[model samples]
Target chain A: MYSNKYVTIYTLVMTVIVSVLLALLFSGLKPIHDANEAVFKKRDILKAIEEYLPKPLDEMSDEEVLAMFEEQIEQQVLDAEGNVIEGIKADEIDLAKEEKKPVDERKYPVFIYNSDKGKLYLVAVRGNGLWDKIWGTIAFEEDFNTIAGVSFGHVGETPGLGAEITDNPAFPAQFKGKKIFEGDKYVSVSVVKGGVKDPEHQVDAITGATITSNGVTDMLKEGLEIYLPYFESQKKS
Target chain B: MSEVATKKEGLFGKKERKMLIDPLNDNNPITVQVLGICSALAVTTLVSKALVMTIAVIFVLAFANLIVSLLRKGIPKQIRMIVQLVVIATLVTVVELTLKAVDYPIWKELSVYIGLIITNCIVMGRLEAFAMANKPWQSFLDGVGNGLGYGIILILVATAREIFGKGSFMGFQIIGPSADYLIDTTTNPWFSWYMPNNVMVLPAAALFVIGIIIWIQRSRNPKLIDIS
Candidate 1:
């Protein structure tokens, strides 16, 4: 049994040594960690144009994917008023942080992927899910109204039900060719209940997942509205 | 095991090897002692998930054991528990950061559970029971054995659950799609060939599987049975 004086000294020395060791370990690992994060984000963004990639997404190595991103993708960080902010990389924008800022002050990143067929503009969106935050990248065709593809991800949702939005491909596939604007009125898109009778503006809601469905609906309406100014400017030009 | 003399066991001596092998069967951390069951149930839904969980547990348990064994002599009697906790917590954080930076998706799926590794009784149990008394190398082997012991069971249960529940093994579709077996009206679909057992996906299924394993283990090894 250690004496009280010995115990106190031992504790202090152990704590100091452990703390310093951890600090050094963390600092050394930070760059590789950050690089992994960047690659992950890039992969998610690239996933939006998965169908258009030269080879299957699964077959492509990290270097290949990064090369594709550099060669075929154009990055832009946009202000709320549709101005292109220079000097800031699109990948550096953290939507979670931007979500906390005032609407006008928030920055949005757009990834334009050039495929052999045409150009695809991918926009990032984030919102609350049933349990936590859900985010996605929705890619638009040149017309800016027709959805080319979409990729949704979530923090936590009911694994069997609400999670179908991400886990089930049919849910996202239903968005293809679904128009975002009905003759400039900006109807966005709806996650409809019962059935999606109006094919152009709605997709079938996840059964028994009303809250998550509503969350997606709200996410799309608000998330798409943020990029309207930039769309309008592009249309004018 | 107690009859073995207290002579210093060589690095891979018979006694030291028993420390590693015993936990796999007769002294399993999960089945025999019934420790760390919560994580066994939660993460074993898929073989892939269970595999990742296993690797993470192995890393944390081995390192935590080593650190505790090294500090065993100097640690105060009054603050021993706290010291073990601090060591375990530090190791868990390191595992978490490495997972986050290296494999973000699995880390995301195994999220919260990694933090809960600090609470895993197996890690703390080894620190107090074995590491505190044994040499550093022996303690390390014990940790690995227990971690692997826990992992093997987890993988078996997860494989069964995923196959029965999802009709997939590690995300690959082994069974044909449900749409092919639709035999009912548009509103309510019934399967003609086979339907995935929805119950298997729930956490409760792991309990039954674990129970069956214990039954088999005890039946084969009669010495494990206890009767009053």
Candidate 2:
């Protein structure tokens, strides 16, 4: 039988102790956690150009991924007007937070991978999926119209259906060699169900995941259009 | 409660052993008592996800039990539940932080479920039913037993779902189309005709697997059958 005074004291002490312990653990582990996240982002970015890497992304260690990102990838941050924004690392820009901003005010991060053949530009995109947010890094050939490769990520989507966009290699593989421009018109690749009539710009969607497939379609159209100006400016130069 | 002159039951006596072993079968947290079913259905889609959930639950449950049992005598009856929750929440946070630091990808996948562990009834249930009334060591054993009980069922359902649903185990393709499977359905004589059942991949399918488990368990152990 605890008195009111004792109960109050007990609760206070427990709360204080727990809070202190949690705060300590959180602060202590923050650096390592941040590093892990950075490595994860770098790894995903590199996955867009995985074929060009000397070793498979899976085989590469975290250090190697970071080193490869540093050595091979050039970071660029672009405004809606396609002007390069200086003084910020591309990976440091949080796309989710940027998504919350107004369209013209948001900044986009681009990762340029220097390969033996040419420079493959990787741009990050985020949009809504059936259940939650889905994002991807798209790699484009120097011409900025032909897709070199792609790697997708999702917060929450039905596994084996919508999640196949990331889980199944075949899904992302379809983007390879796909053209995003049709004679100077910026027409981002579309995820088509039933059939793909345009072999160069349309790919088959995951079966039974029509909403998520459509989400990808809409995401690519809007996400890629934002970079049309940047691509155009780079093409002229 | 007096300390009477009696035979000292060493560290792990028969009673303690029961506390550790009973939950694995007769007193299973998932199949028998039907506690923590929400997570059982959600995380069992993948063996890997279920395994991570199991480990996280075990860590939280065992530590929560130990801490609650240790403080049982000092805890006020009026605020015991809140105290228990704080303990569980702290441990769950620890699991989340550690998982993020150690494996970001798995952390990303299991993020929501890991946070939900704070609300997992089994953790609170054991604290209320067993830990508050038991010795620290015995309570710890009860926690582990229940955790393992929940884990056994979780892994079983995940294995059934993943194998039948996706033709894979722990993300390794075992049986499916001939392209990349370890056991190529096109070439493997045994599974040549076997096609993955799409129904098993759905979250609703976990309920069926759990229902079958409960049915078989009750049938085999007549004591578990409801007579009322």
Candidate 3:
């Protein structure tokens, strides 16, 4: 039987020891963890234009991914009015954090891939999925309406269903070459269930995942609409 | 000293061997004891994920058991459960941080499940039922045996799910459409009629697989059958 004093002392010592150990480990490995996360984000962004990359995203080492970002990719931060916000690297902008801010106050991150052909504009967007937040990086051709490629990511969507947006290659493949503009109006792209009637503006949705499909549609409509101003400015320049 | 020498069992003696091997079958964690099923269902959708998860659990459980057994004397009975929790939580965090630094993709895939290991009943159950009353080496073996027991079922369930559900084994397409499969179903002429069952991909299917495993295990080892 432990006396009250003994029990208190035991608990105090145990708590202190566990906290110190965890705190030391966490601080010691913080740099590596941060580096890994940075590379992961870069990989996801690059996955949008995987077809244009010199090598497959999976085959590239972390150092290679970082080097490619440093060499071939130019990043920019933009405000709601389409003006570039200087001194902030595009990769530094956390879209998840930005999503929490007021719509007008949010900053968008754009990655421009300098390929031999031309500059491909990649933009990030975040929205709600069936279970949690869903995000995607969409790349547009120089014309700014044709989708060159897209790569989606989700936090907690169901496996084999909603998560197919990221897991299945075929899902993102549907967006390739799809036009987001009808004449001059911004229609974005729709993930239509059943059959895609408008091949120009619609893609077939994932089977049995209506909410997530709709989430992607809504996310693209609202997400791409914000960047239209920036695209217009870039086209003018 | 002579009495102590006489009492000393060899390192891999009968009792120690029992501690290591019992949970593999008769007292298996998942199939018999029915612990740690939450994570079993969640991460077994992919064999790679399940394999990584099993390694993480084995590491955590073995260390947690050894530490708890070593501290069993000093851990106040009034706060034993809390002490056990603290130890398990610390081990889980360690695994999480290390995994994040070493294999970011697997860490991302197993994001929440790694953290949920702190609540895994098998870890706590062993600490309370076995570690608290056993020697350090014996408790360590017990922990490993139980983790292996849990892992066996996890990998088995994942194999069934991944193969039947996705027509893949550890991400290699084994049988499916001609475009993805290793053995082109379109031209294979043998598996052309087989389509991957989507139900097996669902989390509910893990329960059915586990149920079948439990049934098979109990049927073979009648001693494991519940009389109650």
Candidate 4:
């Protein structure tokens, strides 16, 4: 039998060994992990313009996505007032963390996917879902008013219900061609229950997912408001 | 103690082979012992998710068993459980990191389940029950056996759920577009009748499927049933 003192010594030695091993393994894998995360975020951004994609999101390889993103997408970090912030990469900013800060202090990322057809402005937004956080990228066309497309993601939501905001293609598809502006007034799109009566400013909410639908509505209204100043400046220029 | 501990068996001997084979059927980790049922329920919603999780568990369990078997003697009696836990946790983390690095899509769908493997009882149960008393080779086989046992049930449950619940296999729609075999949606847009069983998509469905599997498995093998 192992003595108490021996047990303590063995435990300390094993703990030290395990800690060192884990630390080394984590450090060794950090680069690949970071690269994968980068590509995943890029893929999500590209998902916003899935219609214009050369191939479907599932068909395109990570390298292809990274390559397409590198070639066509230009990223800019902007302050609340719409001024471009230098020395910061758009992808590096964590929108969920940024959402917690005051509006003036947050640095917003704008991803512009440019091609011969036109330029699409993708803005990142994050807000509370029924259970946890939900975030997405909403892309705007050259007109800077109508939505080109949108792709939403969630941390955790009720599967088959609230989670359909991401899982169901129809939910996001409705946002296409929907306007963020009602002729010069900033009227962000609403996810209306029962049905969307207005063609421009309203989208159909998921029938069983009122809270998550409302979350999207609130996220769109507030999340897009931060980008208003930037959109206004773009329209003028 | 050393003499009894070092009674090494042949690499592929009968005992060692049984260690690998027994968990698959009569002594299954899921169906017989009913360990690791939580993950089975969580990941079996999709076949692809279940398969990926099974593979991850296989890697973590096999290596953790081998390493623990190798270090069985040196592990202090008072801290043996802690030692086993540390080893399993280390392997699980490595598997998680590798999955994140190489197969990012599977990792995305699997999400927290890979991390949750560390909590799965089968991994710890093998390390304690078999690896502690066996040679490294046999311990490795035991890990493989239990992993496969857990995996088989998961795949069966996932297949049932995916087919009935989602009407799909690994996210591909297996059921024909419409119950009417000749209907073309592009031309008419009004001729489609394939409704997925919403109940099958839920976690409760996994429990039902697992219950059926256990029932069938036990019915065939009366020895697996405990009268006591």
Number of the top candidate by DockQ? 3
lDDT per residue for candidate 2 within A61-108, as digits (tens), equals: 999998887888899999878789999989888999998899889999
lDDT of 1 by residue, B152-174 (tens): 89999999988887677888766
Candidates' chain A TM-scores: 0.95, 0.98, 0.98, 0.96
Which ten residues in a row are the worst by lDDT in model 3 chain B? B1-10
Cα lDDT tens digits, model 3, A128-207, are 89999999999999999999999999998888899889988999999999999999999999999989999999999999
Rank order (by lDDT, best first): 2, 3, 4, 1
Off by over 4 Å in 4: B1-10, B176-193
How do all models score by TM-score?
0.90, 0.96, 0.97, 0.91
Whole-model lDDT, model 3: 0.91
Assess each prediction's global lDDT (C-alpha) against the native.
0.85, 0.91, 0.91, 0.85
Interface RMSD (Cα, Å) for model 4: 1.4
Better of 3 and 4 by DockQ: 3
Worst 10 residues of 4 chain B by lDDT: B1-10
Residue pairs with backbone overlap in model 3:
none
* Ranking of models by TM-score: 3, 2, 4, 1
Comparing 1 with 2 on DockQ, the higher-scoring candidate is: 2
* Tens-digit lDDT string for candidate 4 (B1-228): 111232455577677677678888888898888899999989988898899888988888899989999998888777788899999888888888788888887788786998899899999998888889777877888899899989999999999998877667887765534333333333445535555677887788889899999889888888778931
Model 2 segments more than 4 A misplaced: B1-7, B186-192
Q: Per-residue lDDT for A17-108 in model 4, tens only?
A: 88898899889989988898889988888888998877799898879988987778898999978788999889888987887898779899
Model 1, CA-based lDDT: 0.85
